[model samples]
Target: MDFFKFLYRSRSAFDYADDNPFGISTLLNAIIKRLQQRRKLTLLLAACLCLAAPCYAHAHIFSPLLEAILPRSSSEKPQASTAATDTVTSDTKITLPTDLSNPSTTTAPAVELELTKQPRPPLSEPSLYALLDAEFAANRGNTRRALVLYKQQSFKEDATAVFERALGFSLNNEDVHESLDFAKSWLDQNPDHVPAWFYVAHLALKAHDYTLAGETLNRILRYDPRADLSEILIGIYPENDDDQRELLAALQPIDSQQNASLSVLKAGLLNQFNDPQNALIHINRALLTQPDYVPFITLKADILRKIESTETVLSYVNQARLRNPDSKNLYLYEIRYLLDLKQSQQAWELLLKAQNRFNDDNEITLLAALVSLDVEQYRTADQLLNILVKSPAYLDQAYYYLGISAERQQRFEQAKYYLNAVVREDLVLAAREKVVSFELLNDNIEGAINTLQLLRQQYPVFAPDSYVMQADILWQHNEAEKALQLLTRVSRKYPDNELILFARAQLLDDSKDYLIKRTLLNHLQALDPSNLSYQLSYAQLLLANNRSSEQGLELAKNLIQIRYDDPRYDNELQLQALNLLASNALATENYAQVINYLQTPYDVLPTLRSGELLLRAYQGLGADEKVEALLADLQQRFSFGQRNVNDRVQLY
Candidate 1:
């Protein structure tokens, strides 16, 4: 202990001089004198020596950590600092020496060693403060400052700042790629940072970088495969031809063991690509995993509907309804399938049932009106539409249906009023038809023609019927040549239309030769072979044009035979056939056959043939009873019976 104290004497003397070196010796001598007077002269030296040992021992113990405070100029101010801005000093006082190799080296004899003190290059307070302020500002969620600082970094800590700043910016902004790039930098610095990995993977997904996203997701799975992020990874991963194959390969370990929702999503992807067969297989597998998945059931039903297996679709939808009875959308799906089958009445019944389950639902009500209209249940449709128009959700569609229902009932004025409120141009043609027909029915021929002319001006190429309508109006007004011109234009554009051919025949028959009329009639007849009207017109045309005596007779016979079982009577054809038979008999001078035909009779009233001509035909045949019977019938039918009697007598 004495030797150890002796070895540290030099450093102790140096510390004494540094603090109170010159005055300490004098104070010690005075203390010795005072002790001599108080205690005794003999003990004074021992007491001074004993105190000096402790002072030396204390100095030696602290020498390794505390360095000497070197004397400074009177004018220099002691540096003030905090942890963030602490300055390293040459004159170490109590701080631990950073360089442990030279622990004994001292700034002052009593203080710890200074291996080296390379004073940091002086930075202006404003500049140093700015650097720290920039760090705070970067951390303050300012992306621009953070990016600048990050780019300027050349150290680990600098990179750390950049990573943090990037994360902040990413969360603040919505650009997925920018967020991903920043997260990548952060991952480079802190590859094991879980939140950073999570965000990077998420951003990759949002950026639609499937390859990058998969890689990031794989990294996460490597660390935590069964983490909450597994679902997210599956959602964003590609499901294309090659990708699906790859995914199936990757998911082999978890094939039938995946969570219910993931399996459902996988099944949906298969359905989207039109592989419903495989999709159904996957969905069944998913249901075995979790039978109560409503979304899965809904998806199955939807896919069934897509393939037009309506019965199966209905079956699945019903099953889904049983499982989740409150599903409005499921009922809607059922209604749509029923409507597609033309089972509108059945669809309406389902809609009514749905209404009971979900009353006042605007969508269901709108669907109801549509089904009603489809089935031609106009009155029921009108009632539903009228109620729907009051709700904002269905006003437009309801109004359109209301107009259609009015049109069906021949309430043209009301129909037009409602139809005009419908803004869709697709409905314009139907609206124009109803409006024009209404005008024509009201005896407003010019108005009807003008409306059709307007339609032609608006959609010239599409509304070819306008030309035909204009021709008919013109012919009715006695402008035969103008009517022919319009009819010719329409016929040229729509040469195959039987209506155009028929209309042309009527126009020509009024003003042209029998041959020309017969040609138009035949054109109509050839296009529409089954129509009784066209057949009758063709027979009449043949008779007038002197086409062939046998041909005309055969046409009339064939028309009667073809139309014999037809429920609706071809009144015009039957009358024309009877008149033509009488005319043919008279032309051939077959008096017996003429009398036979005339006596057999055709109609109660001779709408085509004059009554006097009938009486003449009876007289010519010498059938006085038939003539007298016709007179009595005429007396009952006509007001001027006696006045109308023409006595010059030849029926044929």
Candidate 2:
């Protein structure tokens, strides 16, 4: 009966007993039997009632419904209050059936639900679509709209991916201030992100905010001590000394004694700013920790050289060599220093030692070859250069040296082949000059002229030299008129060029135009008054013309007295001066004096001209036995179809 009444009140006020009295009685009997069998039947009945309605309005109905369905125990005490209260919190509210059996109505207290704040969940699929939209805008060059959407998404979720994308887009668009803001936001969220710190530093550097950039770099170094500062420092172009000092000040604090790389970097920065003294201090500090460090040793030597402390530079290099005897760089440095000191023999010896140690090193081999060439060991240089010709790094230099070695050996074809292969701008002119000479030596006059044309077309900087070479070739071939025309054309084009002027003068001298020759020589002397070669040439021309033989003889004597041991003293010029002196002496009939001047032994003498002059002096002295002995020796020394000494020299 109570269940029927409960259902009756849940739907409407209708009595099922009135409609079907027998059915109501049967249903009541079944419910009573089930309740008697099991006390949990009330929950089943309440669930059925809830299912049948499916739209309960209030949960308070459950209080009355349970009160009527559940049988109270005999010992259970009743509360004084007539109302029952139940509170529930869930996504959906469910109302229970109210009791209608009791005439005194059961009143259920209203359900009181409390709400509290909950954290927001992560962005879901819809947010991803929004991000895709942002990407589309960014890709379509709508940066303003894209930044708006990106900021919305980033602030909504603060994802690392979103932050990175926004930052990169801003930087790619050259919105440095926007990129900086994004970097700051990223760092704020992820303080330990090294890449974010680097981005900030880069942006700061672009903005010329050295302080922020340096601070950011310092943060990076704190995270990774081995990070290369060179990449960051490359963009930092300080405006003046004060700016440079400011940058140095910022870097110095980060350079600790334990970090040798940072110290070296700081030293390099200081050196770049022309503060080598301070750079030396930092380098020494680094060396104190790593005394045998090769780069530091090299840097120290370079700093010493910059200060003109040549001896100290050598000593530093030697110290480094002692520490690292097998270091090829130190050996090369010492060799270069020796070469700079005009110690070719010493340089060659050092290079030989280096080659023994680093035989497979192409740079070492190349240096050895160059030093060998300097010492006139053409065969050894040829072997080394042949090995280097296939190397990409040394190909041009190797070909150049090979050409020079072949030229030295008088192998004209081989010289032309190697010289043609050279392409480096610094060596190209020299190689072309050699090629021209080889062509002329081979009697290929057309080929020689063609090469000069090509050389002038390819390298205009050497056009004057090419013009002079072409003129010389024409003059050699007895095309005196063409030679003079070419010389005049080149001289007019390069009016101030001493080489062209000298070429024209030589042509005039060949024509015995002594006045014009003297004027040209005077102009050359005025152009470079200290050039000993020009002075000697002028003196020889004066002697040749017999204009001032005494004055020319004194000048020639003074020039011959110049020590030829110095490499700067041109051997060819000295020999010319000696010949001029001997010729002037012979003109004056100073026979004994001429013999004394030309009496330098044939073995010690460098030029055939000296021997020829000596033979003339012997003829002047009427020393028949001495002349016969010299002639026999010259014939034996120059044995390959050699001409007689009388034919070679003008025997007075």
TM-score of each: 0.43, 0.47
RMSD of each: 27.9, 26.5
lDDT at 525, model 1: 64
* Cα lDDT, all candidates: 0.58, 0.67
Among the numbered candidates, top TM-score falls to 2
Worst 10 residues of 1 by lDDT: 64-73
Question: In candidate 1, what are the lDDT values of residues 1-652, reduced to their tens digit?
Answer: 3422433453355356436634444534444455435443234324334434545534432221111111111235434222213221212111211221112222211112111232222322222122333333433344455444333331123133234433443344324455466557546645544555556665665556656655765664554433444324433556457665555444433443334444555567667667777677767776775575676777777667667566777877778777877888778877877777777788888887887788678778777777777788887788888888888656767777798888788888898788657644566666677677778788898888888888878776535677777787777778989998877877787878776777777777623467778777777667766777776766776776573557777877775454546775665667666666666666665656655554544354444254444655666677788787766665566632444445323222
**Clash numbers, per candidate:** 10, 1
List candidate 2 segments past 4 Å from native.
1-127, 134-158, 165-195, 217-243, 252-258, 272-277, 287-293, 304-312, 318-331, 390-396, 409-414, 420-429, 438-447, 453-652
Check candidate 2 and list the clashing pairs. 58-95
| Deviation of model 1 at 324, angstroms | 1.3
Task: Give model 2's TM-score versus the native structure.
Answer: 0.47
Residues 512-627 of candidate 2: C-alpha lDDT, one tens digit per residue = 68787888889999999988877887888878877357777777887877875865577677777777787777777777776777666355663566666666777777788887
